[model samples]
Target: MISLTMEKRYEIGLDSYDRLFPNQDTMPKGGFGNLIALPLQKKARSNGNSEFVDGNFNSYEDQWFYLSNLKKVTIEKVEEILSIVEEREKEELNQ
Candidate 1:
C-alpha cells in the first residue's frame, strides 16, 4: 500500500491496476521498471537499516508490535487514490 502511494507520489511505475500514467513511461519501450530491494532483510533487519519507520523516521523498537497493528489497505481506498491522481494529472495537463 505504501509502495503504491509512493509510486503515485513520485509519478513512477504503473498504478495498482497495472496501468501506466503519462508521467511515467516505464513500460511502453519494452523495458521493465526499476527493481527495488525488499526491506528488512536478515542483515538490514539486524542493523535497523531497512526497517519501517514512523512520521519522524524512527523505527519502532518492537517491529512485531508495529506489524501486528497494520490494517489491510482496502480496494476502495486504492481506487479512490487512483481516481484522485488521475484528476490531478488532468488538471495539470489543462493548465
Candidate 2:
C-alpha cells in the first residue's frame, strides 16, 4: 500500500448555523463541504502471468499520476484550519 500524508488549509466564516451550535459542534457533522483526505494502497495484478509484464509497469505510473493530483497536507495545517473554523463558529454563537 502506498501511504502519503496530506496538508490542508482553510478559511472559515460564521453564519446562522454557527450561531445555533458553537463549540458544541466544532466540526461539520457530514457533508460535501467537509474536506477529507484518505490514504490508499493499490496492488498490481497480472493477468494469469507469473512473470513481470509491460502492463504492470504502466499501471504503476498511472497510479502515481492519479495520487499526485491530490493536494499534500500536513497534520499541523489541518489542525490550524479546523481551529479557525471552530473559532468562527464560536464567535457566531456568541453573536
Candidate 3:
C-alpha cells in the first residue's frame, strides 16, 4: 500500500467563539481564533503566563503554514491540540 501526504496552509489568530471561559493565565484570555500569531518573547513562564502561548495570534494572519514544517513546533502542536480539545467539546455537547 502507498500513502500520500497533504499540506494545509492556515491563518492563525485570535479567534472569537460563542462561548467564553476562564483562560487561567497570568494575562487576560480572549477568544482564540488561531494560534501561532507571532514569535514569542524570550521569557519564562510563571503563575501569570504561559510557557508556550507567547506573542499575539493576530500577528500571524494570512501566512501559510504546515504542521510538519514550522520554526516553533511547540506552538503548532499546541494549536492542533487545542483544536482537538474544541472538537471533542463540540462532539460531547452534540451527543
Candidate with top TM-score is 1
lDDT agreement with native, every candidate: 0.68, 0.45, 0.42
Clashing pairs in 2: 6-73, 7-72, 7-73, 7-74
Residue 82 in candidate 2, Cα distance off native in Å? 0.7
Q: For model 3, what is the error of residue 92's alpha carbon versus the real structure, in angstroms, after optimal superposition?
A: 0.3
Show the colliding residue pairs in model 1.
none
Order by lDDT, highest first: 1, 2, 3
Candidate 1 lands at a TM-score of 0.53
What tens digits encode model 1's per-residue C-alpha lDDT throughout 1-95?
Answer: 44567666876434434633443434447543332333645666787668889999988887778978999999999999999999999999999
Better of 2 and 3 by TM-score: 2
Model 3 clash count equals: 6
| lDDT agreement of model 1 with the native | 0.68
Per-residue lDDT of candidate 2, residues 9-48 (tens digit): 1233334133331223334456322122212322213333
TM-score of 2: 0.30
lDDT of 2 at 20: 33
